[model samples]
Target: MNRNKDKAWYIADVGDDLIYIAEKLNTKANSEDYHFENELLMLKEVLETLESLECLKEHSE
Candidate 1:
């Protein structure tokens, strides 16, 4: 007998939350200090997270 487990779909909940916060900060507080840095960091994190998820997806397929 052969058996296979179902794979779970990937979701970026953390990254999406970060993205939403970053977007709001960047747009709502244009003149605030450290806003740019935080936004950039959030974007970087999102990109890295997506990349890792993609790698996992490919491996699972």
Candidate 2:
């Protein structure tokens, strides 16, 4: 399988989980119940990396 396609599929497969985490980050529970800033930051970084990969793939085509 193509690397980019594999990455895309992986992203799609976990899309719901990402959304859930993002929602949590925006909620009062996140502010009062736990310290998830680091994790959320990492998640955002991973998403940025995926976006960069897609952009690079498009330009390199």
Q: Give the number of the best model, judged by TM-score.
A: 1
Q: Ten residues in a row with the worst lDDT in model 1?
A: 1-10
Tens digit of per-residue lDDT, candidate 2, span 1-61: 5876876776775676677777877784646668887667868876786777778779878
Model 2 CA deviation exceeding 4 Å by range: 1-33
RMSD of 1: 5.3
Global Cα lDDT for candidate 2: 0.73
Where in model 1 is the C-alpha error above 4 Å?
Answer: 1-10, 22-26, 29-34
Give lDDT tens digits, candidate 1, residues 1-61.
1112221222446546576976778676776555466667766776777787778668867
